[model samples]
Target chain A: MTPVGAVATIGRLCRITRVTWLSELLEPGRMVSTAIQVGSQVFLTACLWTALYAHTEVSAGLQEHQAVGYAVLAVLASRLRPLSRDMAPDSFYRHMREGTILYWFLRPLPPHRYHLVRALGDQAHGLLWVLAGYGLCTTAGVVPLPDGRWTLPAFLVSMFLGQVIVYQLSLILDLLCFWTVANSNALHVSHFVQSLLSGAFAPLWFFPGWFTTANSFLPFQSTLHIPLSIYVGRIPVNRVPREVAVQAVWCLLLWLITRTLWKRAESRVAVQGG
Target chain B: MAGGTALRRSVYRLRLSWKLTSLNVRARLEYRVEFALGILAGILWQASVMVFATVLISRFPGLGGWSSGGVLLIASIRLLSHAVYGVLFANVNRLHAIVQEGKLEAFLLRPLPVYRQVVLHQFHINTFGDLAVAVTLFSLALRRLALEWTPFKIVFLCAAVVGGALIEAAVQTALSCAALRSPTATADWTGWLDHTLSTFGNYPLAILPGAVSGLLTFVLPVAFIAYLPAAVLTGTYEGTLVPREIALASPCAGVVLFLAARRLWNWNMRRYEGIGG
Candidate 1:
């Protein structure tokens, strides 16, 4: 493709994503629901870090200010992931169960492309909420900005790669719905594993050496912890390249995995008739 | 004759509920693999909570002067209360989904009390997973604390468990009632409430701001479910706005909440017009 054409394609995708996001934000009911959901998350993080920092001399290698950044960023970064990002009513399993997945097959577009487009919409919506949350927390003096000057751009790059990795991983879970009769339970288990290992609840620094060592091999850490740690300046600026490289590797591998699974899942799609 | 007839009718309703639950249980058993997978998932999910608590405490040896054992005991009580809630009130917890799908009409037409009907429509054995985790943690906490296990203490513990369960159910029922008015709003509210409990319930109440802590104690009163009970048992009840003596009233608090929630449920029921009646 020509460079101009490729740029145009990306711009169109961004426009579509923005439209979906604005519509959701404009809905009063949805806005209120989103506010409450986001508010509680920010409140929970504030309370947790406040409490943790209160009694402990220091947190998982984080000073008090860095602790607040880590806590706030972790919660927001969690919402930025694709597979589990907020505000989407139709999960892959739910659509498959109702046989509405066949509707996607009828479109001229490839299934992966269709899902990616829809995911962009959901991602935009979640990003808005995350920004709102961060703004609110900062204004309330509950969270602080990153101390390092170079951290902002590096954090953004890592966060972008981390989300790509999440999208691919979520695609794998979405593909499982084709073969498995019940995928909701699988989603539940994965959610627990993801939240625990990704350092959303607590930093990986606090875990036992063996656990953290083993976690280094998994992609979950790259999803939230690596990017978040970067934002809080826990990882040295020199080590940022290596951590980002790890995330990129996971993204490429999972993307290939999902591509293979999608082919198999395509053959298994049998629409039930009324 | 009237009293005897009323007594017989109540017994008959109770029998019907049991029969319905047995049938539901049998149907669940038919999906043996799914049922087994669900139980395993439940256990793993609950275990992850323990892992979080363990990791948190490993960093901070004693949370605000509360011993590690005291923290574990509090966490175990929260899980225990959750187990009881899951087993008994899981169906009621789905009221939002029911309201959304326009299925409430079927239950409203039933002869039995709507709450009883909702509670008995499904029997969840997956709660066993939560129960198992809770009991294991409770036992470990007991050993670490080395408290004397007298008959009176045993009885008090039993009552606390039941009371904690009741308190959780009352909160759940109240949320379900709230769903009847603004289904979507209350649904989100319930989710917020659940998030609040699971996230903050493990830590000492002293960590929260005074206003927020007071809300958890008096308004929502989730503290009575686990924190207060465990604190009373460990004799570490400090920094609470409420007096230490009131901590022992956890069981009584549960009963009061349940009765009050029942009243709220009935009031909401009268106003409910499911998706335009």
Candidate 2:
């Protein structure tokens, strides 16, 4: 493509992102809500970890600071694709229900690219919240800085890969709506599962050996746990490469699967009112 | 005659609620597989609490001097009451959408109380899963406790569960008043409160620092939902900020709070211009 064409495409994608952001912009209250929720969550999470560590110096190979740091960071990282962002029934299923999904096929941009660009926008918006919270918490001394010189760089790389895996997994969930029209329950269940398995609710560390071992086989932990563990230095700087590699492999597999599903989903689409 | 009229009124409400609930459940049943998965989701929803409670007990042994069994009892009480709240009153959480869609205007014209009509708008299909897990945990908690099973204790336990549900209802009801004015903003606050409750509500607040604990007690009153009652049962209510007498009357707090909140809701409704205007 010509430079002019490429620039125009980039500009259009930026505008396409409004599907992910226009509502929040239209209602500034949502922004205030995000601030309050993020702040309180970090505080509450930090307190819980510190309280738990009060009795014992180390449980599951993590000290007060390490565990506290991990828990606090998990709360902030969760801001990346906060659960509440999707609570409003808008997106694929709503579009399908309202019989407007065909617009995806008719648009100049491919449906899959449109879907992904929206997620990209959502994550970008979420990243702003994450950065602000991270800065505030680190300054406030609620959360500590990375101890190792390479820890911050390694964590950022791993976190980027992990988020790619998250976007693909979300795409798969979105595609399932083509098959199951009333899949709200499935959506809720999937969110809870992701939160539980990804170590957002609690570090996979505190869980029993069997639970963590089982979680290793799933892609969910690649989304939040690995990056967070790397951040807190629990997974060790040496193992960061291997962990990021594993996350990369999951991303590749999910990408292929979601790509194929998007093709099949087009044919399976059904409108709500015949 | 007044007493008879009151009894008749109660019966009428109950009968209408049952009819509406059946119709709602039937609608849910149209998607059989999704309905089944929804129940699983409900159980999973509550299971997150259980998982945290289990991890805490197994790893740490005791929190705030409360034993595993005592903590489990507190959790079970909160979960069961939560099931009751989920079934009967959680619909208020969706009030923002209702008001935005102009459904509230239609509800205001109905003969029944608007709150009741709004609540019974649809059955909470997930409560089936919630109740199953809650009952199972309560039973397990019972087995763990070595306390004497006196009739008074059993009755108080039941009352505490009801009180816990009422307190939850009261909180959601108060939040719904804001939904009338700013549907979008209130939605976020409502979601935040639910998260805070689910995340922090199950534990013994005594374990937290004095300031945070006091916030939960005085500002939020989440402790009265189950922690204090469970603490009182386990004999750990002594260190709490409230007097022993007030702690013992935790159930009464739910009653009084619910009544006051209901009155507030009525006043808020009268002032409600709604989003449509």
lDDT per residue for candidate 1 within B86-147, as digits (tens), equals 88787777677677767678888877788887788777776888899988888877777877
Off by over 4 Å in 2: A82-89, B274-277
**Best TM-score among the predictions, by candidate number:** 2
Q: Per-residue lDDT for B56-172 in model 2, tens only? A: 877886666777778788888998888989989989888887887789999989898899988999888788888988888888777878877778778888889899999988998
**Tens-digit lDDT track of model 2 for A9-105:** 9999999786667867777888888898888778778877777777799888888888888888888887777234433556676777778787888
DockQ of 1: 0.46
Candidate No. with top lDDT: 2
DockQ scores for all predicted structures: 0.46, 0.62
DockQ category of candidate 2 = medium
For candidate 1, give fnat to 2 decimals: 0.42
